[model samples]
Every structure is written in structure tokens, then in C-alpha cells.
Target: MSNYPINPSTIAAPHSQSPLGANISSASLTTEQEFETGIRIIRDAYRKKIATKDAEIDALYKDLRRRDAEIQ
Candidate 1:
């Protein structure tokens, strides 16, 4: 046998035509736009969540310092 590996597609049975095959080109643009929009929304939400958490931690830290000074 030759050293070259056999291609699986050549040996595999034919698959039924996919529904998305014809519309893939057109669908890809819309899919990409949606994907980008989703990413932007997720990033914005994540940033907001982190900022809120940081603010909460800062407030708690300030309270702890004040309590410590009162005790002393």
C-alpha cells in the first residue's frame, strides 16, 4: 500500500443533502453579525457585573476599616 493516508470522504457512504447547504453563504453573514452582537452584549454585561462587584468590595472594605478604628 502507498504511504499516503486514505481520505475518509472517498470511502464513506454519501450523506443526504443538508438543508443549510444552499443558504449557507447568505446565512453566514447574518450569523456572523448576530455572533458579534452577542459577544458585545456579553462583554458589556460582564464589565458591568465586575464594576458592581468591585464597588461592593470597596464599600465593605471601607466599613471594615472604620469599624477597626472605632475598636482601637
Candidate 2:
């Protein structure tokens, strides 16, 4: 057989490490601190929404009062 160069592709190397959170670790990632942080985030969102809605409701109420006064 004529001298044929060995293919480098045929050589095997150590298995490459997999990306993180490819399995059960992802589910276990949450801990007590994370839970608290998530709760805080959600509460802040709701509080902001409530504050905005309160302002909108107050504006609507004032508009309604003005309409009533106009009618009178």
C-alpha cells in the first residue's frame, strides 16, 4: 500500500465537557435565597402595577366628578 497519511479525525480525544444546566442541576438551581429574591421581584412588580392603577383610577374619578358637575 502506498504511504497514506493517517487521518487525524480517526484519533479520539477526551470527551468534551457538557454545558451547565443540561439536566437535573437546572431544577435544583433554586434555593432559599433565590426564592426570596423571586418573591421580592414579583412583589415589586405588583406594587408598581397597583400604584400605576391607583393613579389611573384617581384620574378617572376626577373626570367623573367633573362630568357630574357639568351635568348639574
Query: Which has the greatest TM-score?
Result: 1
Give residue 58's error in model 1 in angstroms: 0.3
lDDT of each: 0.71, 0.69
Off by over 4 Å in 2: 1-30
Clashing pairs in 1: none
Candidate 2 local lDDT, 1-72, one digit each (tens): 769998989976544323332333444444454566567778999999999999999999999999999999
Write model 1 residue lDDT over 1-72, tens digit each, in one string.
Answer: 999999977784554333433434543345455566667778999999999999999999999999999999
Q: Which stretches of candidate 1 lie over 4 Å from their true place?
A: 1-29
Q: Each candidate: RMSD to true structure?
A: 7.8, 11.7
Candidate 2 achieves a global lDDT of: 0.69
Task: For each candidate, give its TM-score against the true structure.
Answer: 0.57, 0.57
Candidate 2 positional error at 8, Å: 25
